[model samples]
Target: MYVFSAQRRAISIICIYMTYPYTTWQNCVYSIDRR
Candidate 1:
């Protein structure tokens, strides 16, 4: 059970790291469009 939980946590962390850059880039595009 501990290993499963740890694996789940790692997957979530990886997902967040993967998406962070995409969200940041999207926000930058939105800001540029506002200009």
Candidate 2:
């Protein structure tokens, strides 16, 4: 059970890292469009 929980946590972290850049870029584009 511990191992499975750890694996899930790792996957969640990786997903967040992968999406973080795209989210930041989207926010930047939105700000530029507002200007």
Candidate 3:
């Protein structure tokens, strides 16, 4: 049970981080396109 919860938390954190990376990548692309 403890292992399952730990995996869930890790997955959640990974998902959040992945989203953040994608957003930053998109923002960078937009800025470059604007220029």
lDDT of 1 by residue, 1-35 (tens): 13436655565566567667676544543454466
lDDT of 2 at 4: 40
- Candidate 2 lDDT score at position 18: 66
Candidate 3 C-alpha error for residue 33, in Å = 36
The candidate, 1 or 2, that scores higher on TM-score is 2
The best-first sequence of candidates by lDDT reads 2, 1, 3
Clashing residue pairs in all predictions, respectively, total: 0, 0, 0
lDDT (0 to 1) per candidate: 0.54, 0.54, 0.54
Task: Please report, as a residue range, the 10-residue window in candidate 3 with the lowest summed lDDT.
Answer: 24-33
Cα error, candidate 2, residue 18 (Å)? 0.2
User: What's the distance in Å from true for residue 4, model 2?
Assistant: 7.3
Candidate 3 lDDT by residue in tens digits, 1-35: 13436655565555567667566544543454466
Off by over 4 Å in 1: 1-4, 21-35
Q: Write the per-residue lDDT of candidate 2 for residues 1-35, one digit (tens) a residue.
A: 13446655565566567668676544543454466
- Model 2 misses residue 19 by how many Å? 1.2
Estimate the TM-score of every prediction. Answer: 0.42, 0.43, 0.41
